[model samples]
Structures are given as C-alpha cells and as structure tokens.
Target: MTHGFRVASLCLSLGLLVSVVACHDNKPAAETRPAANVDVINVALRDVPVVFEYVGQTESSQQVEIRARVNGFLEKRVYTEGSLVHAGDVMFVMDRKPFEAALDAAQAELAQQKARLVTAQANLDRVRPLAAKNALSQKDLDDSVGQEQAAAAAVEGARANVIGATLNLGYTTIVAPVTGLSSFAKKQDGSYIDATNSLLTYVAKLDPMWINFSLSENEMLDLRTQTQNGTLKLPPIGKLEAVIVLADGSIYPERGYIAFTDASLSSETGTYLIRAAMPNPTGSLRPGQFVRIKLLGALRTSAVAVPQSAVQQGPRGAYVWTVDKDGKAQQRAVETGEWNGNDWVIKSGLHPGDHVVIDNTLRLMPGVPVKANLVATPPAAVNIGGPDGGATGGQQAGAAGASGPAAANANAGANAGTTAAQPTAASGASGALGEHTALYFASGSSSLDAQSADALAAVARRLVAEPGMRVAISGYTDSSGSQAANQRLAAARAATVRAALVVAGVKIERIEMRKPAQIVANDPPDKSRRVDVMFSPAAGG
Candidate 1:
C-alpha cells in the first residue's frame, strides 16, 4: 500500500497541503469516505440525580364485610348503589312475625307466674300463724313456703325468655357499621338470610385512601441504613406530600402523606409493604382504582449527568466520541453508572469541559470528521422532584449506543458540536506558529520519540500561558495492519502526547485527544507513526 511513508521529503508537502485545504474550504471534503456504520457523541458535563418510580394500587383505608346478626329474611335495603352511607344506617330488614309472637308468649307466661306467686304468698301468710300456735301440722306450713318459692322461680324464667325474644326481633333491621359508598347488596331484598348475610355491600372510605406498595428487602435495608445515617431522610408520617396519576393521564390535584409502613418483612415475598394516604374528598379517586405512586420531596444538589444520546457502545465497552480542534471524531472508553430518567451518570472517563457527541451518528466512526452544536437552553425545565423518579436498570444497559426516540430528538442539537478534521495546508507565518510548525513522524509507529514529544510539550506550554488556545492531537497509523489494530496504535500515540501535556502541568481542560486519526500514509518514516497536532483558536473563541 502507498501508506506509512518511511521518508521525510513528502511530510512537508502533506503538511502544506493540509493547511491550504483548511484555509480554502470551510467544510470537510473526505469526511464522506465510507466505512463501518456507527454513531458518536462528544463527552460533556451535566447535572444528574438519583431517583426511583413504582406502580401501585389505591385501597380504601377501612373495609368491612357487613353480615346479619340474627337469622331472618331481608326486608329492605335502605342505601342507594355507589352512594355514601353512615354507620348504624339501615341496610336491610328481615321478617318480624316469628320474633314478635315469641315476645308476646313470654309476656303472657310472666303475667301468669306473677299471679300464682301472689296467691302462694297469701297462703304462706295464712299458714305461718297456725304452725306457730300448733293449730295445724308443721308439715303444712313447710309446703306453703315451697309453693311461694316455685312461683318466684317461674316469673324469673319468663322474663329471661322475653329478653331473648326482643333481641331477635331487633335483628330484623340491618344497617351499616361505618360511613362509605355502598355497593350492591349481595342478596336481594325480601330474601331469606341468616347470620351469613353474604357480603351485602362494601362501604369504602374515600376521604383518605391508602396506597399499598412494596419495596425489596435489599432496598428496605438500604433505606433504613441511609435514614439512620442521615444520608436518606424519611418522609414524616401523615406529613410527606404525594400525588396520584390516573389511567387517563391526568394528575390528581390534592396531595397526601406517608400513612403507615409495615413493621415486619413479608415471608412470602421478600419485601416490605408501605401504605401512603391520599385525599379523595371529591370522590373522583374511587376504590379498586389503579395508579402510579411517586414521592414528591427531596433532591440532590448540583449533580453531574449527561444526556443518554451522548453515550455509545464499542467493541471493548461503552464509550463517547469527542471532537478535536480540526473537527475529527475521537473515541474514549467510559464507565457509565445508573441512568437518571433521560440522562446517565458518568462514573469516569469524562470531565466538565470535554465535549461529548449528542447528535445522530449514523455515519460517524473513528477518524471521521464532524461538527457539534452547543445547547444553550434545554428543551424541558428541570424535572426536579417530579414523577419520573429514575431509570430502572435493564437489558438496555448493555446496548449503550441505541437511544429511544425521545432521547434522540432531545440531543439533536449536539450533533453540531463535534470536531471535524480539516484538510492541512501551509498557512501564512504571521500567527502563533511558525510557517514550518507542522506534525512529523517515524514509520508505522505510535511511539513519539523524545524530539516529537518535546515539540508537542513546547506547544502545550505556550498554550497554557494563553488561555482559550487549542491544540488538537490527531493520531495516525499506516495501513499495514488490521483496521482495529491500527486504530489502537493511533489512539495510543495520541494518549502518549496527552500524558506528556498533563506531566508538563498543562490545564487538563485545555487539552483534547483525537484517535485512529485521519491517515497521511506513504513510504516515508517521519510521517507514518506521527500524531498530527494542530494549533487553533479555542471553540467559540
């Protein structure tokens, strides 16, 4: 191949050509060169926080099954369907004929017993004096006393029977125990029913409905520990505010509180139950209703985050592509943490000033040219303490580059914020660099000799003194090796220069690295293993 030039005669010509092209054309011409299809993003800083969301159901605070206290037929149902009814409100009535007749019989028995008692008492009074005077046998007085005792016992038995009968008669009328909306009676009116009334109706309390949800055992422990340590604060009982999201996509106006939390962990399901109370005075939030439960308070301050679109998947791991001074794409390996709603929390491999690709990268790859657009105003207001708590980790974590439709649209602007490699051409010697100040290299190597490293170091030192100056380190490799291996070689060379700058005490934010760079190949040794470092004005300068 005509790549990896091993000589010095052509490097000067190549550098001169690149400079002329940069000055002559405002756009990249070779960027359209076709290769493997891919997308890219520029690494940048953002605000990210931790959040969580869950699905739950609405339950009545109090629910009871109304049953019959006595055996009888249901006479009437006093409450209307789906209407509020109070405790002691009549719910049903049974036939009263049997109980009423029983009461009357007991009354008659008690009256007869009373009359007999009066007669016996009179006989006892008359016989007592005779026994004392010896006018009659002592046995006769004893018999009178026994008769009076028997009559008194009979009266007491009759009174007990009357009380039992009256209680049974009262059972003929049934009523509600607590106030709530009444459901359809289980058994029809005028139907014979016994102690088992068969769930006549359900009365659900709505003023303060309970929302039941569960959290994993691990999560429970984490929460407990965090609260105790003051890292995570628990919402106050009956004080923490919450909102209800209905199925129709409308938000409930009233707020609620954290009512109760289960003390014991459930054995069947390794989780703890939580009951949050919500206001439903208008009766709009009905029982048996399903809803999305969300916690409304608490927030983290000035967190670091990035749009999901800025991250991508690579053969080695997740990555983000950034731009160099000349607009060439450079890939960097990154460690991604959990996603916070529409963004991701970057654990490593990025900084506050480094630009991350945020646009569609269907045609982008290592060494490809690009243009990035900076986003001044975000599309949506900060969703602070809002319902979209956080992203639930899933299979998508492995596929880093694929973004949902919403994420793609939200990050379109950053598509214009990338680094596109410009054609190199010799420029007028009137600026920061001398006319001969251009990149040179040894053949087919990523190792920068002491001379090259020192040259780049001097440039970095000068740029450090001049804030807002930029020097893009573009690495290249000969086509003698596989594309993947060559890409690594190019990247290693760029990384080498970056390390030197950092060692020289260059501001970390001012240095950018371009990898698997735009190739300038031939038989020459000086240009093959070189990193083409270009000096230019800082972005938006």
Candidate 2:
C-alpha cells in the first residue's frame, strides 16, 4: 500500500507539470508582443508653392563673330586674347601701305583731271567768242564744249576712286563693334586674310546673360493636365521669376525674368526651348556654362505632402506606411510628384485625416499593431528666399541671413523636414576628389548638360587645389547607332570634356585620355552616353 500511494503522487505531479506547460503555451500573444512605436503625422491639404528646376545653359545675349571686311594680310593683333574689349577698341591691323598708295594715286589723278577741265574750259571760252565773231567755225566751238564735258566726268570718276581708296584704308584697322569679351585671334599676325578666311575672332556680350533650357513633351502634358484639374496654378509668363544655381551649388545673386518661350516644339530634340535673361553686371556669368534654373511663383493648391523619408520604394512602386482606424499598420501605395524642399508632394493614394508613419517604418507590417506618436505636419511650402520672401502661398520664412540659393536651399531642407544631416561643401569636395565622377551627355551629342558641368567644375577645383593629382577620362556611346558613328561620337565627347577641363585651368599634361571600349548591347542609351573622370595622386609626377 505504501508503493501504490507513491506511484499515485508521482502520476499527479507529472500531470501538474504537463498542465503548467500547456497553460504557458496557450497564453494570448497580445500580452507577450508589444506594438511598434512610430512617429506619425495626420495628412491635410494646403496650398504649397512649387519651384520648377531645370538644367539650363548660359548664353550671351549677343554673341557676335568678328570678321574682316576687306581682304589683306593681317599685320598685327592689337587686343589681347580672352580680354574684355570696349566698342571701337582696335583689335587688329592689316597692311595699310597698299591702301595708302592707292588713295594717293587716286587723289593725284583727280588733280590732273581738274587741271584738264580748267584748260578745256578756257579753250571753250576762246572758241565761243571767235565763232561768234566768225573767226572760228561752229564745229570748233562744239569740239571745245565736248572736251570740257569729258574732263568734268573724268574728274568726278577720279574723286569717287579716291573715296573708295580712303574707305579701304580705314578697313585695314579692324575694331570691335561691341563692348564684350573677345576670343582668340583666328588669323595670326603676318597671316594672309582673304574673303574665304576672314574670320578674326568672336565677342560675346556679358551683361544680361541668357539662360536656355528645354522641356519635354511629357512634362508639358502633365503640367497642362494638372492645371486643368485645378491642382496647379501658374503665374503670368512675364511675372515668373528666375533664379540660377551655379555649378558649385551657389545661387546667382542677380534675379532674372522669363524672356522667351518657343511656340512650337523642336523636331530634333522633341522639346520646347525656354529662355531667361539674368543681369550680370559683374560679368561673373559666361556663355556655354551649365546652370540650374529655378522658376518660382507657381503653386499647388489643395495638395498633400509628406516628409521625403516617409516614402519608400517597393517592387510595385512607391509606398508609405499608414495607421488604420483599428491602430494597425497598413501599406498604402502612393503617386508622388515633385519635391518641395525636403517634403514630397503626393498626387494620390492618401486622404485627409489619415495617419502616416514617418519614422520607425522598418518594424511595420500589414495588420501589425502600432503605437502612433502624432507629430506636427511638415511645412507646406519650402522657403526659397526670393523677391517675395516666402509670402506667396504659405511659404515659411527663410533662415535669417541666408544668402544665395545654396544657403536658402540648405535652410529649407533643415526647417522643412530633413531627417538626415547634410555634408558641408568642403566635405563634398573631398569626397568628389576620391571617387570617379561621371558626366552624362544627350544622345548623339557631345555637349555637357548642367549636371555634368557642375561635376566638371568640382573636378576642376580639386585639380587646382591638389597639384599632385591627375585625372583619367573615358568616354562611352550607345550601340544603337552605327559603329563608326558611335566611335566618333565617343571620341568627340571625351575631347569635349578635355577642352572644358583645360578651360577651367587644368593643364593638358595632367589629364590622361582613355579610349572607350564597345558598350554592352543591353546598356541603356542614356547610361552609355557618359564621360568618367578618375583622379589619382602623384600621377602627374
């Protein structure tokens, strides 16, 4: 009986242990798992100022090609190459000895003709009186009259020749027609200049620089659609303000206005060209420079925006995490538009009063419980710091003492909704010097776009700062065109980059050119049209 009681107690204990384990397993998951903590903002509609940015090239308001008007040997180049020249400034001098001799000969001929006219007139007066007195015949009087008339005509012709010769002499001294920047002399001193090879140089007016940019057909259509739907409001073309961001990310101090827009699209590029005129009293802006153009005075009415960090890209498209009425995390697909400072404009997939998760989004999943900490909505408008001072359409006040577009943009990102720290200009330059910088080009074109120009500018600055650094440049082209054409284009693109670097004060010896290999067949055309610049230390030595 003692053994039986022990077995029964043992069995009871074993049963209790199993029941305890099962009870632990059956406990509700809600009590074990905690809701994800996230920062959220309630969506609302407001009018936001929209700033349109484009890569534009600076052009001289008046670019004139200086050429010789008369044929002669170039004797001397008077003006310095690449120097500013005023209107009526002597630029070149041709051989003047020949023209001077011609003028003297013509004058002497005129004098001789005048003397003959005087003599003929005297003889005619004698003949007329003698014929009236019957000492000479009527034919004699007529002959004398004809001689005087012929002499007078010869004198007139000689005088015209003298004037022509004088004008020719004046043409020998070539002068600048406009006050502007002068280019290198095409014909050197002692070089023969003729009608076929008469181009001397160029003069580009520096004041009131023109900024040219193009807009694609798709972009125009989308803008029109937005306007028709009451989503976008644009100011009058003349009232639209323009601001330029230089290659170094500095804003041009002077403001500009929209000067022109093409009525028809270009068949070659399939885009419409737009131009702006910016005052350049200091002559800081030059022709053929790539710059960023910002067009302000437009607004997006009743639009929803979220911090750029809130938007995440997925396989389907861009999406954001949102909180539902039941406090569960749900993924919402959204259509995004242009960026206003640090905030992104949302075109669809969100409604007013919806909760958007701005932080701790990585821990979110469909139907997962979340603890939403409500936060203030991002600023409606990015303070661009222009003529209006952010007064139009809910633009926030710009940072105090922020000058130029770079400073204003930096402040805008800070105050609007930027979550990450930005690198300073010094740090950015250092980073650029340590890596391979790429400059892209348009299809079948060797011209550098604004972004490429900016990159090259940075590279040039680095080259200037570090004397030991050398650069290796390589060009590429797509496989769509003929192989020969592609090869030529690649070479041209590389040459263009090298020229730009030289213009930026980089020595030609420090730059190494590399021949481009055939690009992969599947590479995108846009990706293929590029020039890569790699910097190496002590390579120059």
Query: Looking at candidate 2, what is the lDDT of residue 170?
Result: 96
lDDT of 2 by residue, 1-541 (tens): 9999999999999999999999999986666568999999999998877787555678899988989888888999999999999999999999999999999999999999999999999999889989999999999999999999999999999999999999999999999988889988888999998889999999999988998876545456656766898988888888889987665556689999999999998654445678999999989998877665678888888989888889999999999999999999999999876556667778789999999999999889899999999999877665454222222111111111112342334233322211111112211212344346667887756777654554454455456445677877777756675888888989988887776665444578999887775667576566677777766674321
Could you say which candidate leads in TM-score?
2
For each of the candidates, give the backbone clash count.
45, 0
Minimal lDDT window, size 10, model 2: 392-401
Question: lDDT (CA) for every model shown?
Answer: 0.59, 0.75
Estimate the overall C-alpha local distance difference test score of candidate 1. 0.59
- TM-score for each of the candidates: 0.48, 0.61
Runs in model 1 deviating more than 4 A are 1-52, 114-157, 195-198, 225-230, 236-240, 297-541
